[model samples]
Each structure stands twice: as structure tokens, then as C-alpha cells.
Target chain A: GAGVSQSPSNKVTEKGKDVELRCDPISGHTALYWYRQSLGQGLEFLIYFQGNSAPDKSGLPSDRFSAERTGGSVSTLTIQRTQQEDSAVYLCASSLDSLPADTQYFGPGTRLTVL
Target chain B: AQSVSQHNHHVILSEAASLELGCNYSYGGTVNLFWYVQYPGQHLQLLLKYFSGDPLVKGIKGFEAEFIKSKFSFNLRKPSVQWSDTAEYFCAVKQALSQGNLIFGKGTKLSVKP
Candidate 1:
């Protein structure tokens, strides 16, 4: 079975530019999550989506960051007016469900560099 | 708010040596614990997880973690390590019965000398 996949393995852009990162979860996973991994922040959760319920955006650092999952499968994280501090490897994960017992599988991640 | 702490930032050991990586979370409620590993060029993968029944959970590659509720800790250990086992280990936690995100610690990088 295919694991999660993220597109544009590496992206470099100037500060204040907008970037969109895409993620395709496993075939039937209903729970999807986004995280950022940086030298300073380590790994931090950004957002989560479960079924048709409201997405959890509590972990999103600021309003400039937002994500959307369409058709309950693919997700895209967009950063508006990116800053140097936003440069990091963006990771996507998914599980069968939102249960605590279920394990989340991660993707290769897209490395975003704010120049 | 829940947070995870990994005691060591990095550890160096020789092959066949015993290994232990400490992890502690600050949450009084019931929680699920997980250990994830990432090889030098690979994506992160689940090593093991502890939900309820057994406190001692075994994972892939001869890795295991013990969940101590009273201590709020889940320490990963292995009796013998191989050079191939060198990687970054992350400890994560999520509140039980909630559809919350996993809170991860600043990972511990293990360097195994062959």
C-alpha cells in the first residue's frame, strides 16, 4: 500500500511570498495531520483533519498559516507572506482514524526554504 | 497544555551496546505514548505505541518502550544496538479519548558506532 506522499520535495522562495504544499494521504485514511520540523522548533503540529469535522487549527502558529482538505483525502497547507522563521520541512501524516490507539504514518516531507 | 521532553539531545554508543532514551510528558490524564524513528534519509516511522493494557511495548528493530503512568514517562530501550540503528528517535503523546494531535518532543539523535 502506498504511504502518504507530499509534492515539490524542495521549494525556495523569497520572504513575503506565498507557498502551497500538497499532501496525499493513504487511500482510506480518514485522519490527516500537518507538522513542521525546523532546527529551532524541532517538530510541531500545525493542523489536523478528521472526516468532515472541523479541522483543529490550535497548533497553527499564526493566521498566515492555513490548510484545507478536500474530498476527505488530499490536503494542502498554504503560508501567506512567509517569513524566514517559516522555513522548515513540512510533514504530512495520516491514520485509519482519529483514535488515539491508531498509529500515524508520515510522508517524505517538503522542505520549504524562505530566502 | 501537554508537552513532551526527551532527556538527551544526542547519544553515542558502540554496536551491541545497551541503549536507553528517556522521555517524559507533562499530562496528568490518561494518554497514549509513541516512539517514532527516522533513519538518515528516510521519513519518520512508528517504532511502537502504548495505549492501555501492557506498559511494556515492543517495536520494530529490537526496540521497546516502557510506559510508567505514575512517573509520566515512556523510556525507549534496546538490549543490543546495531550500526544500522543509528537514527533520530522521537517520543510523542496524545490525550486518550480525544481526537487531538500528537505532541512530540525535541528528538534524540542516536549514533551507533560500528
Candidate 2:
């Protein structure tokens, strides 16, 4: 139970609708990350949050995809106006630090389906 | 930007057979490498990692990986595999200077028959 946990193991939404996925990181973790895994494709980095510093949103596909981490513990990934292409398994990970060497613990992920 | 390549999309082997999975990456700067495995109905778990020091890294489940910096390769190997080794393997990389955001490769699914 110490590992990362994601809510709504699966999500079904209509195209152009909005959906929110939540992640609860490991206790005492200071860094969190979000990634998207599409069928037959690699895991794509979406965003990262390190403590109180500004989050890195370079990997976000569009302005419709947004995420926020409150109090550095729980995070939410909100997809506005979701498209069919946006459907994929959304994974959340957390680590003690943002260092490249740190081991990241991953969640089971939420499978998002856009109809 | 960094990218990872996993040449093997699927592999099938009998129990006790030697196993090898090829992985390569491209990055201009120093990078941290990792191999993760996801068993059926399970989350991804760390298999091995290479940061510095010895290029050969040993991981759990009797698996190991050799980091060949010259070739930009970190290939996973096992002397002999078991049925329990069946899983999807992913290779990932993170730039040493940047924040921790992994660039993962398309996973290779391995099926070991007992």
C-alpha cells in the first residue's frame, strides 16, 4: 500500500467532454510525474512537479491537458475537451527527489477511453 | 530531447533458456538508464538501473544489464529464464541535468514457456 495509487482504474468519457484523474503518491515523496501510454507506443512524459518549484509542462500535448499537485502529496490530471486520440493509460509516479538517479514508484494507472 | 529504442517487440523462449533484450538510447548529455518490468495484471516495477560505476548492473529476479556507453546501449540479459519471467519489459532514460522525467521505449513482451 506504500506504492502510488490512482483513482478510477478506468475512465470512459465522451469526446469534447472533460475528465479528471487523480493520483496519490507515496508518503513523504517530494516529486511527482505524469505520463501517458498509448497502445503500441512508449510512455510519453506529460508533466512533473518538484516541491514548490514551477512544474515542467513541456510535455503536455495541448492547452487542454492540465495537472496540479496540491500540498505536494496528491495530484490531479484534468483533460478538457478530450479527444479520441487522448485516450490512453495515464500513469503517475513519485520519487523522493527529481534527480535522474532516483528510483520512481509508479501507479497502476487509469485507462481513459474517449468515445 | 532523448529517445529510447527497444528492438524486440515480442520474445518467446522455453524455460532454462538464456534471455537477452536489446535497448538503445540517444541523448546528448549524461543520462540515467533503467529497466522496468510489468507482469500481467500488475504495475511496472524496477528491474535494474545504471547510474555510474560498473557498467554491469545486477537486478532482482536474477536479471542483469550491461551499460555500453560507447554503443549507447543497455541490454538486459539473463543466464537462464523461468516461466515467471514472462512480462513486458521497458527501457527508460532520464537526462542527468534535467528534472526527472523518463523517456520510455516501446515495451517488449516476453513469454517464457515452462
Candidate 3:
């Protein structure tokens, strides 16, 4: 089966610019998640989506972080006014559903370099 | 808030040496435990999981983990590590039936020398 996929493996942008990272989850996966990993840091939960309900936006660090899942298959994480601190690998993961035990499959990630 | 903790920031061992990576999670309610591994230049992949079952669970590439509820620990173990085992290991926990949010620990980097 095809695994989760992310577009633009690497992106280098200027500070205060906006970037959109895309994720294509495995087919039929109903749960998608976005997480950020800063330098030498752990995976920081960002947002989550299940089916069609409102996504869980708790982990978004600031108002500039936003995400959307369209057609229940693809997701895009947008970082507005990118800061140097936002330089990190943006990861996308998906599972069968939002259940507590669904094993998540991760994509290679988009490494954003905010210069 | 819930969190996952990985004991060693880094572990280095020679080939055939036994390996153990400690993980502890803080969440009072029911939860699911997972161990993920990321080889150099690779994405994260699930090593094993503890949902509901016998505490001892085995995973890919001759890896196993023991879930000790009393200690709130799920430690990854391998009888003998190969040089190819070098990678970053992560421990993660999901609040039981959560909104699909996962709390991950700072990864433990492992270096296995052949």
C-alpha cells in the first residue's frame, strides 16, 4: 500500500514569509495529524482532523498556525509570518480513525528552513 | 497535561549487545502506548504498541516491550543489536479515545557499532 506522502521535501524561505506544506494520507485513513519537530526536539503536536468534524487545533502554537483537510484525504499546514524559530521538520501522520489505539503512519516530512 | 518521557537521550553499544530504552507516560485514564523509530534519513515508523493485552509485546526486527502499569513504564528491548539498529527512538502516548492527539517524548538516539 502507498504510504503517507508530503510535498516539497525541503523549503527555504525568508523570515516573515508564509509557506504551505501539503500531506496526502493513505487511502481510507480517516484520521490525520500534523506535528512539528524543531532542532533536536521532540514531535510537537500541532493539529488533528477526523472525518468532517472541527479539527483539534489545540496544539497550534499561535494564531499563525492553521491547518485544513480537504475531501477527507489531503491536508495542508500553513505557517504564516514564518519565524526563525519555526524552522524545523513538519511531519504528517495518519491512522485508520481517531481511536486511542490506531497506529499512525508518518510521512517523510517537509523540512522548512526559515532563513 | 499528559506527557511521555524517554529515559536516555542517547545510547551507544557494540554489536550483539542487549539494548533497553525506557519510556514512561503520565495519564491517569486509559491510554495507548507506542514506540517509533527513525533511521537515518528516514521517516518515523512504528516499532510496537501496547493497547490492551498482555503486558509483554513484540514488534518488528526482533524488538519487544514490556508495559508495566504500576510503574507507568513501557521499555523497549532487544536481545542483540546490530549496527543497522542505529536510529532515533520515540515514545508516544495517546489519551484514551482522545481526539487523536499524541504526546511524544524527546527521542532517544541509539548508536550500534558493528
Candidate 4:
């Protein structure tokens, strides 16, 4: 499809382990975003990458959550020492730009479970 | 602080019933509004958006939303809903001062009976 694509539709891991989630954004999209959707909670912005520049990591819940967008295209979200509380659907979205009017396209998302 | 509120957490209605979902924002400035729908196991899709020009905008699936600046409200409505409309709907706002990113509400789950 021409939409965003995420790897590992579902992920399960033991507590305190680490996991990596990948996202391939729409071709030529310069803006990439990472968000987490917890049960009963809205989507929480984690980080954003704009054309390979330094990303905005303001929304990361903790230092353990890190993400990187290589060549301003595919991105990866790595969670270190994952805890049970970190279990949620990690969603990746891409947009042409983060401007006030640009609409983002979201991927199906990767449901991560920390056992 | 800028926040979006969705008063209706969950709504249930039979097919063909009219639908309305209330959404309000706290920002007192020009803002862009949007409604996104997520099916059972699908990604979030844009149902409609209001950037400028029209206060009442029409979207796919016979859905429409009116933007009211006075009350800082943007509610989603549909003349008739179907079982396929059973999904989670999210309301979000992009305030002029929001740095161009969206702040989404908790979302409302709609269940339509056929």
C-alpha cells in the first residue's frame, strides 16, 4: 500500500527485556511521529522527526524510550528494559509536514505486550 | 493549556439513527479541527477536517461537522449511521500555538446495532 507500514503487528516480551519496533513511512514524507495508545487513554505523542534533523523527544515518558529516523524515511522505536506498564499499541504516523494544516496518515500499529 | 474534550465517552444507537458527538476545545485562537475514525483493527483514518473557509464541512460516509468559534465547539454529526460505523472516533485540535502538532482527546467509542 501507499500508506505507512509498521513491522511486527504484535509483539510480546518478558518484563525487563528490550524490544525494537520499526516504521516505514509513506514515500517522500518528511515528518514522522511516534505515539503510544494505552488502554482508556488518548494517543500520547512520543517523538517527531523532521527531515533527519534533531528530533523532538519532549513527549517521551521516560529515558528508556528512544526513537530514530534514518535518512528521514524508516524509523525505529526502541524500548529498553521494558516494563509491564509499557505495554500498549505503539503507533507510527507520517505527514508531508507538521504544519498547521497537514494531515497525518497512521499505520495499523504494533501492539506490544510486556509480560 | 490547550486541551480537547469529548463529552460523550461511549454512544450506542440502532442503524439509521441520527448521530452527534460533542467536541470542545479550550484554546481562544484560530485552530484546525479534525475527526479520525479507527475501525476494529485498522489504522486511524481521517473522516473529515476543518481548516478554514467553511464552518460546516462535509466528509465521507455522509458525515458532517460544524465549527462554532463562539463556543469553541466542533461537533460531528451524521444523518444516519450504520453498523459499519461501529468504531472509535477521536477529536483533535491543532491550535495556532500548538507548534503544528495535534492534541487528541480520549476518544468516543460508538457501537451501532444493525
Candidate 5:
């Protein structure tokens, strides 16, 4: 079975520029999540989507961060006016269902660097 | 606010040595516990998870974790570690039966010497 996959494993961009990261969840997965990992820090919850609808997006740091899923399969995380602090690894995960206990399969992640 | 804590930032051991990593959560209600491992240049992978049932749960690659509700802890352990076991380990928790977003602790890096 194909695992969750992310595109542009690494991205380097200038400050104030906008960037988009893509994630493809496994087939039949109904739950998708986005998280960010800063250098030497823990993974920070960003947003979540259940079958193309996001019910909880409180973890988003600010209005600059936004994510959306389409057809319950692919998701895109967008950061507007990137700042130096926004440089981090963006991770995506998906589960068979939206249950809290369902194991999440993670993607390789997109490392974004803001210069 | 709910949060997960990993006490050890890094651990170094020789091959075949016993390994233990401590994790604690601050949530007061029922929660799901998980341990994830990321080897060098690899995506994060599930090592084990605890939702309900026995406190002691075994996972892939001979790993096991003990979930102690009283102490609000879920600690990962391995009888023996090989060089291949070197990786970054993360502890995560989420409120049971609620939204599926996870709160993760700062990962602990394990370095093994063969």
C-alpha cells in the first residue's frame, strides 16, 4: 500500500513570500492533519480535516497559516507572508478514520526555509 | 491546556543496553497515548499506541510501553537496543473520543554505539 506522501521535500524561499505545501493521504483515509516541527522543538499541531471538512483549526499560529483538503484525499498548507520564524518542517498525517485512537500515518514532510 | 512532556532530551547507550524513555501528560481525562520513531532521513512512524485495555502494551520492533493513569505517564522501554535503534522518539497524547489532533512532546534523540 502506498503511504502518505508530501511534495517538495525541501523549499527555500525569501521572507514575505507565500508558499504552498502539498500532501496526499492514503486511499480511504478520512482524517488528515497538519503539524509543524521547528528546529530542536516538538511537533506543533496546525490543523485537521475530516473528509474535506476542517472542524478544528485552532492550532494554527495565526491568520497567516491556512490549510485545506479536497475530496478527502489531498491537502495543501499555505503560509502567507512567510517570516523567519516560519522556517520549519511541515508534516502531514492521515488515519483510516477520525477516531482519536486511530493510528496516524505520516508523510516525509516538507522542509521550508525562510531567508 | 493539554501538553506532553518528554524528560530526556537525548540518551546514549551501547548495543544490547536497556532503554527507557519517560513521558508525561497533563490532561486529566481519558486520553490516547502514542510513541513515534523517526530514523535518520525517514518519516515518522508509529512505534506503539495505547487507547485502552491493559496498561502494558507491546509494539513493533520489540518495543513496549506502560501506561500509568495514576501518574499520568506512558513510558517506553526496550529490553535491549541495537545500533539500528538510534533515532528520534516522540511522545504524543490526545483527548479520547474528541478531535484527533495530537499534542506532541519534544522528541528524545537516542544514540547507540555498536
Candidate 6:
């Protein structure tokens, strides 16, 4: 079985630019999550999607951070007007369902650097 | 707010030495505990998890964690650690039966000398 996977293993962009990071969850997974890992903030949850609908977006640091999932399979996180503080590793995870006990499978992550 | 705390920022030990990493959470209700490991250049992987049942939960690669509700703690332990066991360990907690996200602690890096 293929685990969750993210695209653009590494991205370097200029400040104020927009960057899109993609994630592909495993087949049959109904719960998808996006998180950010940085030196200053550690690991922080950004959003969660259950079957293409986001029910939790509380972790988004600012309005510029947004994510969407389609068909319950693929998700894209877009950061508008990226800032230097946005330089971090973006991680994606998926689970069978939204149950608290269900284990989340993580992806390799996309390392984004805003210059 | 719910939060998790890892007592140690880093741990260094010789091969065959015992290993213990302490973790505590701030939530007061029922919770799900998890220990995740990330080896060099690898994605985060589950080391162990405790949802319910026995307090002692064993996971892959000879790893185990003890969930103590009274102390609000879930500590990871390994009797004998190998050089290959060097990695970063993370403790996470989720409020049981809630749709909330998991709260993670600052990871503890372990360095092992063979």
C-alpha cells in the first residue's frame, strides 16, 4: 500500500510570491491533515479535511494560509504572499477516518524556503 | 489550551543502554497518546500508541510506552537501544472522542554511540 505522499520535495521562492504544495493521500482514506514544521514553532496543525470538507482550519497562522482537498484524495495548500517566516517543511497526513484512535500516516513533506 | 511537554530536549547514550523519554500533557479528560519517531531523512513513523485498555503499550522495534492517567504522562522506554535507534521522538495527545487535532510536543533528539 502506498503511503501518503507530497510533491516538490523542496521549493525555494521569493518573498511575496505564492506557492502551492500538493499532497496525495492513500486510497480509501477519509481524513486528511496539513501541518507545518519550523525551527521556531515546532510542529503545528494547519487544517483538516474529512472527505473534501474542511472542518478544522484553526491552525492556519494567517489568512494567507489556505488548504483544500478534492474528491477526498488529493489536497493542496496555498500560501499567498509568502513571507520569510513561511520557510518551513509542510507535512501531510491521512488516516482511515477521523476517529481519535486511528493512526495517521505521514508523508515525506515539502520543504519550502521563502527568500 | 491543550499542550504537550517533552521533558528532555536531547538524550545521548551508548549502545545497549536503556532509554527513557518523558512526556506530559495538559488535558484533563480522556486522551489518546502516541509516540512517533523520525529517523535521519525519513518521515515520521508511529512508535507506539495508547487509546485505551492496558496502560503499557508495546509498539514496533522493541519500543513501548506507559500511559499514566493520574500523572498525565505517557513515557517511552526501551530496555536496550542500538546505534540505529538514534532519531527524534515526538509525543502527541488528542482528546478522546473529539474531532480536534493532535497536539504535539517539542521533539527529543536521541544520539546513540555504538
Best candidate per lDDT, number? 5
Better of 2 and 6 by DockQ: 2
DockQ of each: 0.81, 0.88, 0.87, 0.67, 0.90, 0.72
Where is the poorest 10-residue window by lDDT in model 3 chain A?
A50-59
**Per-residue lDDT of A107 in model 4:** 94
| TM-score of predicted chain B versus true chain B for each candidate | 0.98, 0.97, 0.97, 0.96, 0.99, 0.98
Q: Best by DockQ, which number?
A: 5
- Which residue runs of candidate 4 sit more than 4 Å off their true CA positions? B97-100
User: Model 6 segments beyond 4 Å from truth?
Assistant: none
lDDT of 4 by residue, A17-53 (tens): 9999999999988999898999999888888888776
CAPRI category for model 6: medium
Kindly list the per-residue Cα lDDT of model 3 for residues A1-115, writing each as its tens digit.
9999999899999999999999999999999999999987899999899965546788999999988888998998999999999999999999999888889999999999999
TM-score of each: 0.98, 0.97, 0.98, 0.96, 0.99, 0.98
lDDT of 1 at A75: 92
lDDT head-to-head 3 vs 6, winner: 6
* Whole-model lDDT per candidate: 0.93, 0.93, 0.92, 0.91, 0.96, 0.94
Error of 1 at A113 (Å): 0.3
User: Which runs of model 1 end up more than 4 angstroms from their true locations?
Assistant: none
**TM-score, cand. 4 vs. native:** 0.96
Distance from true location, Cα of A95 in model 6, Å: 0.2
Which residue pairs does candidate 3 place in steric collision? none
* RMSD of each predicted structure: 0.9, 1.0, 0.9, 1.2, 0.7, 0.8
Task: Write model 2 residue lDDT over B1-114, tens digit each, in one string.
Answer: 578999999999999999999999998678899999999999999999999999999999899999998999999999999999999999999887777699999999999999
State model 5's lDDT.
0.96
Candidate 5: stretches off by over 4 Å: none
Model 2 score (lDDT): 0.93
